[model samples]
Target: MGQGLSCATTQEHGLFSAMQSGDLDTVKAMLERDPSLTHQTTAYDRQSALHIAAANGRIEILSMLLERSVNPDVVNRHKQTPLMLAAMHGKIGCLKKLIEAGANILKFDSLNRRTCLHYAAYYGHSDCLQAVLSAAQSSPVAVSWGYARFVNIRDGRGAAPLHLAARQRRPQCVRILLDNGALVCASTGGYGCPGSTPLHLAARGGSLDCTRELLAWGADRLQRDASGRIPYLVALKHKHGACAALLNPSSAEPLVWPSPLKFISELNQEAKALLERALMDANREREKNILKGTAYSLPSPSHSDTGADDNISEASDTELCCICFEHVCTIEVQDCGHQMCAQCTLALCCHNKPNPTIACLNPPVCPFCRSAIVRLVVAKVKDCDDADQDIGEIGSPKMRKARKSRNFSSEGSSSFKGLSVMSPFGKMGGRGSGRMAAENEWVDKP
Candidate 1:
């Protein structure tokens, strides 16, 4: 029995050697001499002559083996079928011959669970993927095979084909998967690293063209990964300023005020302060430019001011206080040509205080021309009493007494009775005593 087994083993080795060397005539002669040899296992790697023929792309030998009904589904110790070996080596003719002989197209390797399609995409072999896809289409298990091999197939680490393509910067593979309806937003199975949406991956990779393409395809810019970071912020964090700017232009402005004392509230303080400063400076510069004509530095006219020839010429030429949004009363112009009301201008300065630098206030621009305030306005409120009086007197005793008496019940006293007074002079203390005191004070003045 030992000698008989030795003879059988020797014959199998000879057939295996013939298959490996693509000696189809020798393989056919050996198989024909012993019909039982078709079912015989080979020595060495245990791969039969059919397995060797398919792997080496010997289409004629593979056909001859299949015609004899050699087990096409048989796998070696690695659980790789003959068809898998053919596909991996890009043996298109051998693969077609095996498929025609009814080889399983969707069989996965036992070690890696990788179907033939995975190998094709991994190697970037478009033709291989096409062949596998075509064979899979007509199979009885087509739907199951499609799902297992195409739709959600993931590696041991849960990385879909798209993830691999992205990490490798394989744009062509990415496009193929996208065309095949692969989910670009699928997350990998890991912790602390929320898997990226395809857009996030593109941005993180600094593939601007890919990023734009993903955006054009409706990728959400505001989508956050597992880390609470939007894609734009991620770009900024990575110092991709150009990408961040493209994603959100408003982020470029001084939207946040560093100090708390500048505004009434915390929320939107930066935005409000920025807008307020911009509007004030814009108005101030517009007035300064109008006053100085060609000599002043002016921002190019904005679209809103396009038809302003009538208004710019007809409008008052006096400089306006950029801070208060009022005409520059008691005008004080900074070296930067920005004008402000003298009082408003000085309020921005740190006179009679430590750290008297005008930089402390961080004004947006010049108070007069709305350019920029290089040196602070040191002027104070002039003609304070005249300005106050124009609005209304604050401390006149007659006015005070009249204001006080006007609130009193008219029925309470004889002093309040019959106090009918003219409208203009009525509230000034009813004409007699108030009028006489006023005249006396006027006579005493100057």
Candidate 2:
């Protein structure tokens, strides 16, 4: 027993000294003296000799040690494997060697629940990330299972690998995660900690490249977290001017090659596939509704009334919003001949405007037309709450106050009756006459 203990102590001292000096010869001699010395676990801070070699970036020592069949899977007192240390230290060559030797890519340090991938991502080590992912793909399914599960796995704080990459301002790492099916909007941590989505983290980290990658992966920048802060606001709060600028581009400018837009152009095959799926799902729903006769028909092009035809064509062509560039399935053509998409119009008219009126923004101009479009009527989604609100307030005190405030004629109560015109052009001629004209033209032509 005494001899064995003495031998173990000698092995530990010799190995630790060899690792510290990066003495490959001494390490080889010691390992030859006792083959078990390769597995003799003695870490200064609970890190094995492999961990020391990896952290120190001693590639020769690491290669020699790994050749002796030393378990590269050993973790330190902090549960950090050599791969994690190598990644953190930006030891790309050593990392590659270790990964090739079958190091655990998904090993998580107990301190932060951070994996080797997390360390590589957080430190902006693109080569390390590539090496780890490559090795994971080449290994047996059982060996790669941990990393496969970790793609969507969150830390104790619920932060996915994408979130860590974003938070660390690692644009390439963000791209890798997004390509590997990472969730862009997965929430992490809690309310006080903000429970930020990956977009939020990217914005906060001031990395426009990362933010763009997240957006290209279909992350919703407008979604508010538990604290009601969206990704753009998070960017502004964290002083990420470039990221915020990319997210909320100036309306006046045409947005020539914005960073987010540029980033989106680089989406990999998987991101494109995800987008295609979303678009296809939306199209499928639209087709189903059309078959059920619930879908609204578009105005036909057979109309001869030049003025009205021009208006309809212009409305149809410009119906798609510039913001999201999606077809404006629903619309609220304003009185000023300006036609805007439903969501933008609603946000402008009802939510942001002090007085909710058809002419709330510059005498009811069509958001698109910029003409003297009068308060014709609002076309809303079926069973829309806003439509209900418009109808329900006809005789309410609020309507009465609004009538008095707007100096509206109280003679026939037809003013309020026009509000019931649900069709797009129901009030075309008079106060609400345009509605009938537009609807009749649409219905009769089709």
Candidate 3:
């Protein structure tokens, strides 16, 4: 009996080793020699060949094992399915295969009682996280548990996936989960701190990106945890000076995602990305102002992988914004066809902080024509020759001269729409003194 057990253990080790190293021929030969080897698991953890393949990103071996009628939902001793392992290790290929093979994304492990979605968010695997979320929309779990419940599903400690992602500093995962309807302000039971929201977790973790994401999704910075501490206090406690600067209740409010506008929801992906980047840039400028003299300093803005310098060169040929001549006109009022820079556009909309007590919020009006802004999109840059031709189409020499003079006068003063210009060293001398002066500052230009 002892000899037979020793031989079985040797075969199991070989099978697992073959799966881990992605040796397809050796796996096939071993499987052909012993058909039951496919079902064999490790003696201690009871991890099968499927678990090893998925964890190691051996998609070919995983596919072969699945095709051989092996259960994709096979759990190890910790009750962790191969799907969980795939997500935890960011094996997107294996994760997709398992999802297609009917693996359960809702299976909770024994460790934290976290599902594959939680594992994906916790491990900062954005691709795997998105895949699992996409699968959950059509999987049987969607019908049984409801999509919203699955998105905000809690673990043993009652921490939602958003809480985990924020605490782990997974900014992309946090954004993905928020876009897919994860509650931005859902509180946890015991994770990080009791009754802590995702924003609180982000603050405690000292992740400015994660905190910015949560705030853009309309997270309440003033919401306190069970211990009566807000996210600002949490950031200050952790000595995250930059984060604390942004979260300070007295500081100017950062812009939130423009979800209230119906047209914003209908924008194309490219247009949406441009607008989101613009919004983040505006907030970063505000944060810089708030942290001007502090010991903590923000890193320079990281440009997108798409060549930004090339875009900058292209932008130089475009028309300058009449509101802020420093920047190129990049945003367009779709309905009226008026153009402005992104900074001016954001200034028009984010003049006031959000008030949760108000049930109805008004849309911002276009600064040029005073018309309610119905739609906005990224202005497409025209070729240099085309722009020159368009410039020649102006009806009157006097009209062109008047427009040029207006732009020149507004060149250095970007204090449109109640945005007071700050001094280089954070001084506010000669600016409007009171709230009444600030409210009256947004006069229409001729």
Best by lDDT: 3
Global fold similarity of model 3 (TM-score): 0.79
lDDT of 2: 0.55
Backbone clash numbers for all candidates listed: 9, 31, 0
C-alpha lDDT (0 to 100) for residue 437 of candidate 3: 23
TM-score of each: 0.43, 0.52, 0.79
List lDDT for all candidates, in order.
0.49, 0.55, 0.74
Backbone clashes, candidate 2: 31
Ranking by lDDT: 3, 2, 1
User: What's the residue-level lDDT of 204 in candidate 1?
Assistant: 66
Give the Cα error of residue 371 in candidate 3, in Å: 5.2
Instruction: Report the C-alpha lDDT of model 1 over 223-258, residue by residue, as the tens digit.
Output: 677787776776777675444543442321111111
Measured over all alpha carbons after superposition, the RMSD of each candidate to the real structure, in angstroms, is: 28.1, 20.0, 6.8
Model 1, total clashes:
9
